[model samples]
Target: MDNKKVIIAGAGHGGLVAAAHLSANGFDVTVIERFAQGTLGYDWTDMFEKDCFDFCGIELPKNANYVKVPESVFVSPNKKTKIKTEVLSPITNVNMDRSAIYDSLIGFALEKGVKFEYETKIISPIVENNRVTGIFVEKNGKKETRKADLIIDAAGAFSPVRSLLPSNLMIENEFDNTQVFETFRAFYERDMTVTPPDTDWNVYFFHLDKPGISWYECREEYCDVLIGRFNKFGEQDIKQVIDDFKNEHPELTDKIIRGGQFAFIPVRRAVGKMVADGYAAVGDSAAMTVALIGSGIANSMIAGKMLADVVIENNGKTDVKTLWKYNVRYFKEINADICSLDKLREMLCTLGTDNLNFLLNKGVVKGEDITAAIKEGGIKLGIKDLIEKATKGISDIPLLLKVMKTLNEGEKLSKIALSIPEEYDENKVKMWLSEYNC
Candidate 1:
């Protein structure tokens, strides 16, 4: 049989991994990216699981520049209380520059004979009879069509290809403010003259009593600062937050070192439908980030490998039914945890500063609990643990009740996520989607 041709719509981390794996498995793979070569990733660093490279079967980049990410200090909105989390032994997380990660994945794909079309813009998917068959693209000021046996959308959260798909496909085409995190990240020169805080990393919850998070990490030469909100915010809001940080911490200097830009991240569970006839989505296009942290690198890469496995197992069949296996495997192995965590994230957004301060001040929510929830990607407090927390926070019965309600709701969501239809029956999948999303 002739080799199946795969077109990766974006050079997304997971899509690159999938391209490599598919190429290695005797499929022809091509990646089309809007950014030129050597400028494929963001101009900043990100944190992800350290073991993802091994899991994706990609070698770590030579002289990989990274540092073990220390456990973060969660500061109450009032900034009077800080809860330091316990550090995990064996160092589960690492902060690596985004460019280095892209270099590694791109190199791996190249070695596997995957072709790349740099500086190519993907306009939309080419559909016929409700099945995607190729993509419409523009390169060097010229528009053209690229045909492929299958298309993998590794595009970012706002991929036009995903947005423009035919409505009958059942795939979600848009993300509301509640499902997205608007973020501004910057790295500023550190003022050595000023004394740095004792903690290397501090995350401020509901910064300035706003429904958002802001954090600053003190590095040797620079301070990495990120301000994020669930609702839409503008430059003025960003400036206000930066000014607040500068006033609070003299170590954060005015000189910008790098990464002064705004971006959006999907902070919800994976999309209800991620596959259609002859097409599938991975990475941010699938909303595959950890809702609490907006970290998708590890999960996206893992999903890439899972997708490749499914495609190879099915002998390169790209129909919706054949592609549904990838959805089932991903939901069972990964999304259940994300779905559970999203509930907690939603609660944090609405949980006022007073209640949050109370939880921290009263030790109802401890550092270890925070660490566990992040490490495990979900909240899993047992009845005994809940009872202990309730007793400790007996004064705030209403807040405790709210926490309990969130936990219960999270459990229900997880069950629904795990119960994704094993096979692609249109009506059954539609019903499941309604229940799961509701």
Candidate 2:
């Protein structure tokens, strides 16, 4: 393909990964970032799937600061019930230094001849003939139009381009006003005098509310404390909950090494359409963050690679039909099961404390299901998977009803998501999306 000018409208992990891939593939790539130079990324590193980096062909520097999480322990609100989950694996789940990963990707993209426009925020897409021709951006208080063959918005969920798109835009739907889970994560100094817990990561479920969980992870000298609401679970005073959790864990010192972000994580499933004429989206822009875990690092990186490949294979054509392949491959092939977890989220958030305790006590919600949801994006269960629990819980009609409803909805959503069209046929895409949107 002849050299194509590609504009990446964010310098997040997904955008950086896309820049690296496209630049390496002989595209004239330029990445616009809202943050100042050298001030990229969050203070804390996000855990990700190992295969994502490999899939995107972006290698980390030898000195990349990071760790491997072996497992995570889950506890009930009262600490009476506990479940241990295999969260880390050789196949996926690698935790690394957030800044190191960004810097490394920037270095790689730079080496591949990608231009970096720091502190430049995109104002809107330059649309003409029903196609995105470029972008209108502001840099140092000056606005300019930068033309490109394709524009990929890797901006977070609150992307200007995505936001400004006309209501009639094919790729636009339900992204706005979606419930976002706001969180505060801190990697604080650990009192070396106190021995850390046996498990590296401890997760407490049904804490403060029926729908939220609190997490703590030890990274040698420091511990990572993540307190957030579970979307659709319950609305509770987050500040009070965090304070309560802190009170319980005295080992977490005030000396924070990283992270004080009031980050808003998108809890919604992937948007129905992620591509438009001459434009596409990745990462949180496309709602690529996983359903339950709220981790978009791996999904976003994979989205970048998939988008680059589609653009290259289409011979640099930037129309909706050609770019639609990126959505199909990433959604259907990589994460259809994961998308189905949204339905599971609905049931999870609505279940009362009594139901949650019963489910946990009866082994109705196993560690395997959680692992599968994180690893494969959906839990595949047969009659055998629940027959034992059903028999054991025969006396609890309310609990049984809730379980059946959750499972039925999960199955239906999974089927619908898997059958998403391979092409951006307006009618088909709209029809398929109505299942979830309705």
Candidate 3:
């Protein structure tokens, strides 16, 4: 690997983490970044599982920002009922400032001898024999080709390179905007002058109810206001929502540090095929974000490292057969529950307000159930809890029937995900792909 060159298409968390791992493994790695040196990611606070600190190998620099917002309470549209989960274990759900994390990861990767090309745009991949050999990049005023033994696409969810690849090489699909969670969030001045929303962090559900949700967080410096919708809100104006909140707390919204950031995050499960002969995808580009809650910082780091390890373990071969193990390990070890939860997300999102009211307000779906669902791995329900849920289901037969029917179908997906083949058998892999909607 020391003699081999690797090109990562994005300098986001996934690319930076992969660069560090590969550099540590003695590979010559270079990151192609679209943004300039400093202005890379959006202004937002994200929470990752604490295990990422140990497993992802990212060091938290002194003065690193840690957000203190607690778990949010979900208020019903009618406002008659509110649902709150106890503070998730700090050990599992850890809040982090995204900007600080980017700085630390970039600094550490640079120190590890990974090269970065700032203000570079990836034009296209240079494919040879159906294999991604390198990329054509545009920097300054000219376009130049950078060749590498392998190309890793960490270029986020809307990755163009992934789109341009020949259909036969991989599953070529466009990121439909309908599947995106279009979020416009702001960090406003938090004025102690006006009383803020209770729970510090809370969501107002059923805001026109169309497969979307909104929430807010109060930080030391600002009140974070986030409003988002699914498919593309036809006439819904999130800006107006922010304005309403601002009117309520002008003292806090008056002085804005970072006004807002609009980001479209992928809310899908992992991609079916993550590799061609000489290419692999990680992070958002790979659709690695967790389902429903839309968290991927930790998953990307783990995916990046696992991809690098698979490449190394295959004697530095970047062929499809060798790289396929990256998908194996990711689905089996790192994101197995994510696959299951993808089904779960579909089910829960399909349920109308009525179903949720019964589940959340009536305690059919206990707060502990949510705590378990949002945990890093995913939900784990014991036999006792199952019986309890069954007993409770008798009170609401129709809603319970819907839930059970959905759960029964979803379990099939879980079983398929759990039984991923150890070795890549083209036929078996093809079958898995069909089940995974390849």
Candidate 4:
């Protein structure tokens, strides 16, 4: 059989991984990226599981610069109580510069014969007879269509290609504000004259009594600060948060080192439908991030490998039936836990500042609990643990009930996530999707 031609819409981490694998497996792969080659990723660093490279069959970059993230201190809204949580595991995660990650991934894909078309903007998917046959693209004052046997959408959360798909395909075309995290991230020069805080990493829940989270990480030369909200926030909102950070941390300087940009991330469970007749969505395009924190580098790469495996197994077929196996495998193996975390995230958002403060101050939520929820992607409390929390929070019966309800709902969501149909029957899949979304 002739090699299948694959077109990846974006240079996302997962897309690059899939491109490499598919190319190596005798598929003609091309990646179209809006940004230039050297400027593929964000300016700052991100933390993800260290095993992602190995899982994607790519070698770690020799010159990679990274460090183990320090323990994080979760501060209450009122700042009266703080819970310090240790790193999930000594060797489980690493903080690496985003540019370096892209360099490694792009290099690996290049070595595998994957072609790249930089400075190309993907306009939309070209659908013919309910099958995506190509993409309309604009490049250097030219507009044309690039045909391919398969189109892998590795575009970020707000992908025009995915959002503009034909409505009859049943793929979710948009993510509402509640399902997206609007984030502002920046790095400022550290003031050498001022003494740094005792904790190098601080995560403030409900910062300034707002319905979002803010974090400040103190490094040697700079401090990384981020403010994220479930809904859209404007420049004034970002300024207000930064001003608060400046007042609290004297070590933060006025000089901006790098990164003062706003980005959107998917902070919900993977979309109910991620495939169509001739297309597949991976990475942010598929909402693969951890709902609580918007961390997707690891998950995206792993899912990319899974996607490549399914495609290769099916003899390069890109039909919905052939690609549905990837969706089933991903939901069963990875997204089930993420679905549960999405529920927990909803619970956190519902808990107002006062309730969160009470939980923290009263020791109803502990550092270990936070660590476990993050590491495992959801809360995993035993009977003894639950009873202890219930007793401690007995004074606030309503809060206790809310917590219990969230846990119960999260469990049910996980079961539903895992119950995705093993075979792709249109009716069965549609019915399963209705329950999964509910």
Q: Estimate each model's TM-score.
A: 0.94, 0.91, 0.89, 0.95
Stretches > 4 Å off in candidate 4:
381-393
Query: What is the alpha-carbon lDDT of model 2 when measured against the actual structure?
Result: 0.75
What does candidate 2's lDDT look like per residue over 286-362, in tens digits?
88877766788887888888888888787778888888888888767766676657777667677767777777776
Tell me the tens digit of each residue's lDDT in model 3 across 1-438: 557899999886777887888888888999998888888777777777757756877665568676664866766655456678664555566777778888888887888899998898998888888888889889887989999888899998878678788887655457665456887777777777766655356676654454666777766667777766665642247655656556544545644577476788887677788888879999888888877667788888888888888887777888888888888889888566765566666766677777766666766655565655555444555446556776864477677666665555555665677777777777887777787662
Off by over 4 Å in 2: 173-179, 230-243, 246-250, 384-387, 436-438
Cand. 1 TM to true fold = 0.94
Look at candidate 2 and tell me the lDDT of residue 176.
Answer: 37
Give every collision pair in model 2: 233-349, 337-377, 338-377
| Top lDDT hit | 4
Report the alpha-carbon TM-score of model 3 versus the true structure.
0.89
lDDT for each candidate structure: 0.86, 0.75, 0.73, 0.87
Which candidate achieves the best TM-score against the true structure?
4
* Candidate 3, number of clashes: 1
lDDT of 3 at 283: 89
Candidate 1: residue 155 lDDT (0-100)? 92
Q: Which scores better on TM-score, 3 or 4? A: 4
Any idea what lDDT model 3 has? 0.73
RMSD of each: 2.0, 2.9, 3.0, 1.8
